[model samples]
Target: MEAIANGLILLMLSIGHAELWTSVINRTHALKIHEVYLKRLRHVLELLMVLFPLVLLFAVGLSDPGVLVGGEWSQLPLWWQPILLLCTLGFLGLIYSGVRHQFYRPPRQQTAQESELIHLRERLKQDLIGEGPYHYLAGLPFNEIFSVEFTRKTFQLSRLPEKWEGLTILHLSDLHFSGTLKREYFIELCRIAQEMKPDLIIFAGDLIDRMECLDWLQETLGPMQAPLGRFFILGNHDWNQESLQIRQTLSETGWIDLTAEPVRLQHEGQTLFMAGTEAPWMGKLQDVKLSEDNAADDFLLLVSHTPDNFHWAEREGYDLVLSGHTHGGQVRVPPFGPIFAPSLHGTRYTSGTFFRGSTLLHVSRGVSGIHPLRWFCRPEISLLTLHSADKK
Candidate 1:
């Protein structure tokens, strides 16, 4: 009985220790460290999990368990035993609570059909920005382990016009084009976008990272064609002195700049109102209010760099809002979700499709970012299909 009790205690302690370590690992920010070092640490931790039980068994067997040769409990003051028992009980309670929470948590309602464009995460092991000796040695080995998934989200809107029910908008954002990412990458992305054959292409923001990459814009993004048109808005990154040149380059490439004012398009016997606001970081957004004349029977769509305008969009009675800035927190951990999101409201509107009353907001993880590393948080191209809820 004493041996059995000791074994049970050891088992509980082992489980608790492993659980505590897992929680710490999931919550800890490891992006600051080099990839090579983090990989080595992870390997060591995995090895320890296997060795821990054996070590515990050996220690427990060799140590005194307050038992006598007569098969009776020792009478000597074992004050520490009660304390150990209490700690074990507390750990057990914590484990139970975690399990219950996981099992009882409500599932998030999904409105998107997610599909992988490239299985690069499984195929490639080199980083996208393969430069410098440090990156080659530390990051390259783990490169391309990150995915860039394309999601098709269909939102059933009661106010959606019947003619626009099948209208597909291919949303792209945060294409942080610099020397780090080659033009070939963008060309490949354009090929994929072309194949998807969206009726409209909307670029939310962050088209270029630096002024030098400005020339590559037309060659890279000019190939992406849509039947209706391709519209673009400026991100905070685009609000520099070179912005005028960037806008000119985009215009020459046959892209419509929707930054100055809202544009109304007549498509398939229905009116579609599309508007874009300047990034809040780049000073105040232009006062493009939706009037009663513009509101009647038309589908209102707004684009912004950040999801900060979700409330504003909701208040303005916009049917849909597309955005990308947070990069889906860049790295997401299972159970804990996104570790860090660059938004005013934090991780509240990080990524994916969200319903704010009748308005649907879709935030993309984006094609690329300034930082090259992405874990469970994959970069994305969002394809949104509008469905009229009333027709269904």
Candidate 2:
């Protein structure tokens, strides 16, 4: 029993070490640096996260006079103390994040909401794309890559202006049309989104991973109909491609380039300011005009590719922010939630409706990603219905 307990402890510490460095790698990916540099840093950290634990295990658990043999704690070398301390600290930090995730609640600023989840796999079993990368993993018994969820959620916010009440926005992001999943998958998801009949449509970045998939747009996002219009911003993946061509092709397909400039809409005598930000990757953030009288009355909506911009959006007095780069960590571990999110905030904004001060952020669990794998996390599209809480 003693030997078993010591072995378990070593395993726990190894996991902690990996998690610690994974947090660092996620934040590093959020920097305004080049992708090549970020990839190099990630590889180094990941190697350390794995190999360091194995070295320590060989030294302390597998050798003579080691803990696994029920050796006295004092038998360890003096130099090992600080390393053990760091391992313990990292384990504790991992526990704290888990606790927070287990107890996480929707922000108090949100008054009420309803969510309906539609499992596409069940509805269109034979119609799914049926082929993609990671066939080894996607073929796993419960892999959720093809189980797209059409999540229709309503948000009742006190800040919603009367004119915008009952307004619906279909939020889509991170399509990553890398051909890992065939074009049919994207076409079907987009068709369902159009069926939702939203007043406005927003694609919050990461449209495609392969330029060859560019032709997939017309049958997918091109025909999407919304009275308010379709707007988009490019994500880091798009930056790695022929971004200028991507932008031009998207514009020609009729989606307005929100990152190019801020858009102001006058509706039912109400003002709405909309803009997009692709910071830390693509374009710069567009500033809302201050010249308009009663600028405060305009309901401000900022579309950011990364939810890490939540703080900046809050400070800028945005009423709502939409984003979708993290893909809800691509996979979620129960109790611990998401373990891998590419954001400065770690997994805090993995996917959800979070309210900070006056700004409400809705992060999408995007449809597909580069890895083409998912466990507990399913591909998601959200139809967000905004309602006024003043009626409450």
Task: List the pairs of residues colliding in candidate 1.
Answer: 125-143, 126-143, 126-144, 127-143
Off by over 4 Å in 2: 33-37, 111-136, 286-294
* Candidate 2 residue lDDT tens string, 23-84: 89888878777767887898999889879878878788877568886686678888888878
For residue 92, what is the lDDT in candidate 2?
Answer: 81
User: For residues 25-129, what per-residue lDDT tens digits would candidate 1 score against the true structure?
Assistant: 433321223334545765676676567667655534444443222222344247745644654664564555445434532113234575765854334443344
Segments in model 1 whose C-alpha atoms lie over 4 Å from true places: 1-112, 120-146
What TM-score, computed on C-alpha atoms, does each candidate reach?
Answer: 0.69, 0.92
- Scored by lDDT, model 2 comes in at 0.83
Q: Indicate the residue-level lDDT of 326 in model 1.
A: 77
